[model samples]
Target: MSINWDLYNKRLNLHGSTQRDRLTKEFKIAKESKASSNPSCKTVKVNGIDKQVFIVAKSDKTKFSISPVNSSDTLQMGDKIFWKNADWLITELSLDDDVYVSGTIQQCNYTLPFQLNTSDIIQEPCIISDNQTTVGQDQNKIITVPDTLKHILIQYNSNTVQLQKGKRIFIDKQVENPSVYEVTKIDRITHMVGEHGLLELTCEEGQVTEKDRSDLLIADYVSVLPTPPVSDLCEITYSGFPEIKVGTSKTFTAVFKDESGNVLTDVMPIWNVIVPNGYESYVSFSEDGMKLIVTVASEFDLIGQTITIKLSNVDNPDGITLDVKVVSLF
Candidate 1:
């Protein structure tokens, strides 16, 4: 059957209208983007051409035409926008085209661990020595003599009965030969009476008399008498101040005690007083004097006054006690 041109044209028009309606329906079904919830959104004027853009509701199905307004409202997907003013950072973007921009959002930053300079830290130096040890471990052992060998003497006999003076003798039992005895004294006989000649012998102790012969003997078993050991004879105890004003007397008592702490009474105590600028004075006492009085002259008027006093036994002299003190007379 032959088709009519006019009828075909009319049918074409109807189909075109139907197709347009269908496209419109499809565009309406497409999802639209929504505005961000950030409150910083504001309306600003866009200087460029006006354009219609589709904005989707939060449901994503509804579409709205966003026309450019004078003020930009939070630049939502549905809002009309013309121009952007300044460069603003975008903080959040929603899947539905919601944009959140921030002007005051801080930039990315980081902090490193704290460090100290050389001046801030302090270090102390220490002395370390392997040679340094405890006190008692380094002390010297004291020498002790057996009490049984404290006193011993030996005598020798010779054909020359007269002995010289000031000679020493050595006696020991371990040697095979007899030890030698030096002659310490000599006695000359001048006369012979009757049938016997007079004889005499002398030793270092004194002129050996006939009565002293009982104490002398010639012996095989003998040893030299050991010298008495030296010990701290006395200690001086202080009972006074070291410094005194000029023309003023400072009285201090010194107790003379033996090693056993017994007061030694028969000896005199000697003292030496020293002033600041090298002035020295000596003071001594009688056999019964234990306390000493020291007087200082007023010529030494200096700010840090210092005085030294030394005390000792006058007879023994080897043992000593020392004391020093600084005082202000001003």
Candidate 2:
């Protein structure tokens, strides 16, 4: 008899089951199948149970004879069997030596291993797992400002918070956040100061204004002062005679001015003069003395030598000074 070529061709062309369907069927079949029957497959037994060996091996009858692997031990039928590697449990056994070894079929209480997705895991505040309250101490928090800040203004409801000369605050105009400012100076009372009001605050050089203060909830009405117009007056001046020959006398003078061209007479001005490859010279004067006179030592050399004069006031207000370069020989 010739085989059915068409039927054989049809069977050969048929595709095997898909991975998903195959796995599903495999699990269903395994759950329905009974235990195996083999002496080697019988692993562990529970105490006070039937003296029987529960085997877990490939067999058609799926039955086993319960027997203790060691002769001295006493086991009873209907005992439990536990496998080491598979962690399988056996619920039934038989004591007859002729009976094939088999374990009672039971559903496994297997649990799927838990896995975490780092990308899906959110941070503390956003996740509910974090239940502790966050600490808000001053030492733990740091205030920062943008590099472009040039000045800052601090506004408050009342003058209760006095503004000092130096304090730091933060400001960010681009963001919809409240800018912070530390007190710089409370120069005058509200009624005495001009209409716009004043609350000078020391801040980054560029952070000087508050875009919004409606929600600031403060004591009294207050705000940061606008940037003052920079003065063009000379903050410092240095004057000195040109280079001196081996033995000569030199006179140096310096002048200080405020925002206005008017002279500043609050403190005496000091002068520092330096000669190339020579010792530094310092001179102090009374508030009335703006000029300095000094005699050049005879041992001083004039060749390839120059003098530099610098003038500064008390603590060098704003750390600004004026310098004068002298090269001509006297």
Candidate 3:
């Protein structure tokens, strides 16, 4: 018996449209193709004569789709389709018919906020999910990272320590302690995203006991996207040295910021005073650390001798060290 794969794909596309049409709830897909670096998915009109790949719920409460797209690219594994307030990551695909392609997708339960810790901290929109070989058997979770993280995954597999630590992953929650996972296995698989790859890591849950499962309260991708703060101190802008009279006090302030000159908020500065010999007690910091007050004693009258007011931003440990030279106005 011959299979009518094209007809099967057409039916799948129609079913998704009837239940939830693409027009109202458009399925947005962003991937690089030969034409565009990040091309958005554009299917033929559902009423038109071309393939209109759409998502439909199956009998088992699972979602399925058939992307009979107008482009040369057929739907492949790992292609993310955002529909119905969820990220449906394509995990399986079958292209029996050249005109239409069908695939199976699963819900991305979590978003791994992958940070590329370079000069500028870049946050990768990495959507991921987890599975255990035996449900509730052990604390091991198979972390499935979609193909969008190909470059970051490559850095992860590097033999060099510096390169290996180029990227980091975190999942934070509103609770006291966020769930942590330690990587047990690291591997990759070929996936299509206009030609992207994937990362699959066997992560053992750090919070082993059932009572310590804070991941349950963890914020979703949308919730954590804006909240998780990443601040890298590019430079510190401080007030110029004020002329200090003998036995008087003067206050100075500094602002920490990133490469874009956007002031890094909620960050504190580590103030250090390098005075000549007996001038240690002269300098004192404000309660909130916003101001540094230096009371120059009358005996300290050396104009050339400088009090190195060095401050470091805690966000980036190798933070900027600035000097504040105090000149006495006799």
Candidate 4:
């Protein structure tokens, strides 16, 4: 082949010009194409404050981005993106290439399984690992835990509004001793996603039973008390009274209940002790009005005295009365 340096140089220049023209045309076409359409702008309340953001999305996964029209509001991580029938948490953001946004899909129709340990009085930390496999399945299903999950975050739909952080909720897995869980944290900001926000719960260690597995799959979610207690119902109860010695002390616990006999888990009964006329110096009540302490002096007049310690509350007139006998061995 004959070597033509001048012709080779000219051909190289022409090819470079053609490639530049094609690149420019492709860029113009990409810029003209809409990333997403029919964008919806909404204001979500975060921390009792309103934040406005626009969501631009389509049914196709590739055709989704946040705030395509308006640049004022930007989508950040932890912001929930509701596209189609599924809920997705924004995990990545890209402003280049006509704005590419993507996130992992959180099943809207499924509730995360939480196991609780009820063997002890204090609840154990919630076990949310994805190691357990279901029946007929060789591999375990993956579950996503929020980055801010120091506690259990239960995402509730429409039927879980009554669930609050301080209220106790029932969890039944058909065990002999069913355990109740307390709501620990409630994410008020991301609550604007679907039906309601997410709830943080105190969970113990356990596995989901096969019987309740259907309920979890069907999105029954978790049932909570429709009406939670707000105030005290003014009912007090305690164990039987014991013999009062000269120098011994006894501790008692009073349980408060409501009109429907439901234990007042949030209320503390106000107690007032009315000791016998002469026995006032021997018997006294605690400062918080919950415990009754007794101390008999050596100079007490009667060793065998039948004293009536009236445990009453002015606010709640329906109180109990116990007769404690004071005995001293000389």
Best candidate, lDDT: 3
Off by over 4 Å in 1: 1-233, 245-247, 278-288
Q: What is the lDDT of candidate 4?
A: 0.44
Q: State the displacement of the C-alpha of residue 36, model 2, in Å, after optimal TM-score superposition.
A: 99
Worst lDDT window (10 residues) for model 4? 118-127
- Estimated TM-score for each candidate: 0.25, 0.24, 0.37, 0.32
What is the per-residue lDDT of model 1 for residues 131-218, given as tens digits with 9 covering 90 to 100?
1223342247544432211111111122223223443322222344423333343434331222222222222222222321122222
Tell me the tens digit of each residue's lDDT in model 4 across 187-292: 5554244433454344332333433333332112344434424234442333444555666555555556655677655544555555567667766546445555
Query: Candidate 3, residues 26-107: lDDT per residue as tens digits?
Result: 3322212221332324343221223445445566565555454433446555555555455556666775643346676665
**What CA RMSD would candidate 1 show?**
49.0
Candidate 2 residue 243 C-alpha distance from true site, Å: 4.4
Clashes by residue pair, model 3: 147-197
In model 2, where do residues sit more than 4 Å from their true spots?
1-246, 278-288, 315-330
Residue-level lDDT tens digits of model 2 in 225-270? 4443332333433243244444555555555566445776665766
